[model samples]
Target: MKIKNSLVILLVMAFGVFLFQVYKQHQTQGSLNKTAAYYNTNTPDEVGASNVVTAIVVTYRGLDTLGEVTVLFLTAMIVGYILRHGGKEKPMKNNTSEILITAANVLIPGSIILGVYVFINGHLTPGGGFQGGAIIGTAITLMILADPLGSVKKAVLHITESLSGFTYILIGLAGLLFAGGFLDNRILPLGNLGNLLSAGAIPLIYSLIGLKVGTELSSIIASINETGNKTA
Candidate 1:
């Protein structure tokens, strides 16, 4: 009975959302649906970011970025808490084979470097905090596979997680207080188009995001390993 009721509620809400979207689309005039109508292609070139999507994700819709950060934070916290003492991982010093270790050593640094480039060039490219951060986390994963016993510390991870969260929130508050609105872009020099230092707060945010994801994933893996889920 509960399942049937829940399904009915979900179906009703889904149809309601579909109707709302259709109404919204119908409300917009045909010619007004052009890219220029919704977003500024001019902003990307002016901001020195090659990627318009990056500009949109990190700058124009930074509030959404904040939400994404919050979600990642929450996920890391929830998973960390759950797996911390849950008896789920196996921490063998030799959990990974020698070949995997060698490969990870070779690949990890390169991946981290690429992640940095992505964050630095986010405004002018397709990558940003979310994408770059995920890559950074991947590097940490490689480090773990290479040396399962190499000392993954929660203290360090906590610092990274906290600092990144603080940095993101501080920047947002600065934007709100100084830029006239929350997550405003005017806090830093907007920079020239296609330049490395362009995009102002966007790159800064991305860097922090990279750090956060890297540390969070590292900690999660460590927790899982420590807990007892040693399938790897």
Candidate 2:
């Protein structure tokens, strides 16, 4: 009881400190920091992306984005390895509802289309590769839930993931060789802003990212589901 009370008191104190910090925070002046000012003034003209956040993420901080994807890939690999080696017992099965199966059929196609749209237009819109990939993963999860015994082609997913990652790296190297730096978006002509083909290589890079992320996530989910299906 004393330990519980102590923990509660500590949590309360932390919350109080957070609240104090929030209260003490001052409103920003009209002026931006140097980096922000630079991006604001030059991003549209230089990056040719109306979406400043997309420009910064896909170009200015692209190497960091690559690291983030690599981390996710490692996580998925670890999960699959662990699950594959885990002990298997007699598998328990659950019956899925007809309504759920029907719903999956109705929604999966639209979800995939929306995911593709989001990544393809990452340079011009609010959504990007990660968001689109998550949507695709969700659709796969829904499909699994609707039919647990259904097979997902692991080979195809693996190939897609590998190819996308390879292509992404190639594009980065192209930027380093032909453009200003690694992962630069100016390897190709920056089309008119707000168009589907604008933002130079951003859309292509983001599409590759979406494919890699989607396949990785799906592979992880499929591994988990297969383990569950096979385990007793």
Predicted model with the maximum lDDT: 2
Write model 2 residue lDDT over 1-232, tens digit each, in one string: 9999999999999999999998889677788899999998999889999889989999999999999999988988899888887566555666899899899999999999999999998988899999999999998899889988766888888899999999999999999999999999999999898889988999999999999999899999998988887744
Tens-place lDDT digits, model 1, residues 49-82: 5677776676777788778777877887888788
Query: Could you tell me every candidate's TM-score relative to the true structure?
Result: 0.77, 0.92
Off by over 4 Å in 2: 89-94
Off by over 4 Å in 1: 1-36, 45-48, 88-95, 229-232
lDDT of every model, 2 decimals: 0.75, 0.91
- For each candidate in turn, give its C-alpha RMSD to the true structure in angstroms: 5.1, 1.8
